[model samples]
Target: MIVSDLWRYPVKSLRGEPLREAEVRPWGISGDRRWMVVDPSGEKLWAGEHHDMVTVSAARTGQGLRLRAGGRPDLHVDEPVDGPPVEVRLRGVGHAVSAGDPADAWLSEALGRRVRLVWLADPARRPMSEAHGGRPGDVLSFADAAPLLLATLPSLRQLDDWIAQNGGGAPLEMSRFRPNLVIDGDLPPFAEDTWNEVQAGEVRFRFAEHCDRCAVTTLDPATGRSGKEPIRTLARHRRWDGQVWFGIRVVPLNEGTITVGDPVRAEGTRSSR
Candidate 1:
């Protein structure tokens, strides 16, 4: 198999950027999910709760970030060097420094809420969820659980076919799922289901769990509008344990660079049980 596509979300829940090559860190790819939009209480504002969040785009640069969205001038924000630290929670409250007022005011106007932009300088501040297959030392960025999510093209094609057979509209794009890596090859649908470990290029990853589908996946990324889609179809066939699953959540076993077109080998296959 070969790596077909790669992406990183610099800010959690916002639009992500495509990448040809990425530096894989312990928490995740470099510059991924280090920033986030949070409510006054320091709770993360997810796209499920704020649909407009899907419309916001955060691009990381050598200096910092470029924020873009409809009806708003692009705003540039620098990394928080001397910004005051604030308490924020992913699973639990931790330290995250502020991105200052310009970012706060800009995002507030865009989302039409009093929100602030906070940066997690150190991802080790929060531990991965043990309930989600994380061990004592596993770490995560602002990602919901694991460091990376992988989706295969064959499985997606199978799903699209299912959608067509079940009274579908247009076929959904993989972007709807926000996977970090997209793999392609001649393989059966859900081949990743049994994969316990995989090597891509020089990097190795351990399977954490199957990724659970969420309401945010139902959003039409192009329009920021909601729809009943992959989620609806996933419920019919992929549902188990009261949740619909699609992609695979993976934690990095070694820090290295991964590039598009790299060969992927699924090694050390093991039972999920």
Candidate 2:
């Protein structure tokens, strides 16, 4: 198999930027989900709770961060090198730095709700949830769970076929699932479900768990609108233990750079690394 795509979300719950190459860190891809929007109480906010969040696109600018959405001028904010620290809850309460009131006003105005832009500052602040098969020292960013999620084109095609068979409507875009890596090759559909480990480019990663679907996956990234095809279809075919599953989460065993077209091989077992 070969790596087909790479993406990094500079901010949680916002549309991410696609990349041809990225540095894979133990926590996650560099610049991936280092920031998030949270309520004044420091609770996390997501597109599932506020669909308008999906309409906003966040990218890393040369100096700091840039946010854009319809009907608003792109707002740029420099990294808050000296900003006040704040505690925000991800998997657990962790620390972050506020991007100041200008960013807050811009994001709040765009989403029609009061929220603040907070940088993770330290991606390792949150540990992966042990309920999802995490072990000690497994760190994460603002990503909902494990460091990287991998989705395969073959599996997506399988899901599309199921959707068609059930008359569930249009095939959904992979972006709805927001995987960090997309791989394509001759593997059977959902083959990744059983993979114990895999290597992509120079990085080695162990399987963490299957990614569970949520309302966010039903929202169209372009319009912040919800649908009921892929999730509905997955519920019918991929459900188990009261949750629908899609991509697989992976924890990097070694950090390095992975690029599009990097050959990927299922290692079948954890590497000595």
* lDDT tens per residue, model 2, 149-227: 9999999999999989987677788898999999999998888888898899999889998888999988988998888
Indicate which candidate wins on TM-score.
1
List residue ranges in candidate 2 displaced over 4 A: 269-273
Query: Per-residue lDDT for 134 in model 2?
Result: 79
- In Å, residue 172's CA in model 1 sits off its true spot by 0.9
TM values, all candidates:
0.97, 0.95
Evaluated at residue 175, the lDDT of candidate 2 is 90
The C-alpha lDDT values of all candidates are 0.89, 0.88
TM-score of the candidate numbered 1? 0.97
Q: Looking at candidate 1, what is the lDDT of residue 155?
A: 89
